[model samples]
Target: MYRMYDVVIVGGGPSGATLARLIDQSKSVLIIEKTDEKSISKLCGGLIAPDAQRMLGKFGLFLPKKVLVDPQMFYVESYDLETKNKQRYQRFYLNINRKDFDNWLLKLVDRNVSISRNTKYLSHEYSGDSITIQIEKNGKRDFVESKILVGADGSQSQVRRKTFNDFRYITKYISIQSEIVGGVILPCYEVYFDRGLTDFYGWTIPKNGTNIIGIALQGKDAREKYERYLKNVLGNNFQEVSRRSTVIIRPRRLNDHKTDKDNRVFLIGEAAGFISPSSAEGLSYAFRSAEALAASINSGKNTGKDYRKRSLRIKFNLFMKNIKSIFMYTKFLRNLIFKLGIRKL
Candidate 1:
């Protein structure tokens, strides 16, 4: 007989774990993760906003003391115009070690969640009402039937690759994040702004003497732009300790869930393009999506639109649009000032 579950979640990241924790105890849920007992290594600059904190708190998720408020936020300077004496502004934000925050999120998951590690999904055969999955574990293969499947995998999502064409969207983020043990001494979370980092931002978040300095470039030639920003932030004498590059994806439509076909499998978090297009922040969106997924499942609404309405997708959709529009304005105002000679050329 085929093994069965009400829901089967792939990936044990924040999105998946959060989703599992929120599912009603009455529902039998199973999770498949490829990593070991300790979880896999992740590269990120973990920072949570007020709303994100509140959402996590509601679910009993809390960070360590080290995740304290070091920098509320900061903005270094934006390339408002092509001028010698360009004025730049600063904004402050809190930063935390990526590993610690990730671990904390995993800990908060309710014990009842049956999270299986060192397991992999070979393939899936989808029928009208349910799906059949070929799962691998400890050199053994098993077949499981699940009514609902959630894909919380990151950018390179297998679920997305096999299941949906609609998840495709404009690639807007190109970022380089690094941890430098020795760099120019900076205490605040400073973000340097420029046309390259337009829409996205650059940040120097404190990691206890070491710094997480990087740029989120959304324009053409982002690699060179990102490199230049890294040099400027770290200074010539600075030595590299760590580095990573990432491409961020955003869903096409911001808030309208009218397009969701549902079809048994749900794409949550990065799989669903929940990352804020402007900030490239998705942790909160992931958990919120999980919550929405939970509510939608409880209500017995099986389509994507109903899921979207249940998920915080609508609220976040508005937030994403507003932020994107604001950044566009910032770009526009700067360009207009230079064109009108209001600022130096």
Candidate 2:
């Protein structure tokens, strides 16, 4: 007899792990993760914003010392590369090693929730009340049945793409990051905005003894622009430790913040387009969406309807973020704000 799980989550990151941790214990759950234990590195700046910190506190969780990195930042230095204007803003962000942070979250998941490491989610088909998913592992294909399928995957989520054929609702960017070991660490996080380089932005974050420089680019010559910025910033005196790249998403419309489809499939975190357009922060959204979905499941209600209702606040927040992005991304407004030292510390 074939066994069926109550829920099967793709991508064992923050959203998947948090859902597994919070879902009803009686319900059988399985998480499919592509990355193995030996090599776990997420392409992220690894900064925990105040919103994420509050969400952690609500979960009664505390960041272990081992997960934290050096140079805890209390300010952000913003620069408009085109205008050559700079300003400092007061903000507190806890720096952390993203891999360690993910590992920590995974460790907190309930033992009853099965985690399949190095497994990739290929596709899924709905039949009757359950969905049959095809997963790949070590050159082998296997099928699993679940009453509900959750796509906690990242921006390039297969589940999301297969479910929602429309891609025009959200904007996507390629984020490239490099860690330099010998660069001088800045006292605070540095943000750069240059329309020539990227419509999004670039940042330099200090972690441990290394400086992490990353940029989000949408069009051609992304690597070239990133390298030029790297050379201009580091001045040929730094050793390149490692380079990482991944897809990042920003919701273009309120409709883009989708939580469910057909009352059987669901999405959370960046997969659902809950990331902040202004700041690109998704940790808080990941945690909150997971909680909302878990609540929906544990309520024993129509999970899809409940999740959609619970996610309205998140969508509203994203809407506000989009409005804020207008101010941040508009060159004239940004330059004026910087020149006037508005909110500067």
Best by TM-score: 2
TM per candidate: 0.80, 0.96
TM-score of 2: 0.96
Cα deviation at 294, candidate 1, in Å, is 0.6
Candidate 1 achieves a global lDDT of 0.67
Tell me the TM-score of model 1. Answer: 0.80
For residues 1-345, write the lDDT of model 2, one tens digit per residue. Answer: 345999999989998999999999999999999997668588889999999999999999988999998989999988888888889989999999888889899999999999999899999999888999999999899999999999999877888998996566678888999988876657789998998787789999987777899889887777888888787667788999889888788786878777898888999998998899988999999999999999999999888999999999999888888888888999998888887879831
Residue 331's lDDT in candidate 1: 62
Compared with the true structure, what per-residue lDDT tens digits does model 1 show for residues 1-345? 687888899888888888887888888888888776465356666666555777767877556785464554554333332232234344334566555665566666678777878888777777657789888999999888898877877766677667754444445566678877776655654545565445555776776666777776665677777677766556677777878877766544553222234557787877766766555677777777878887777776655667856665446664666555464337666455535545221
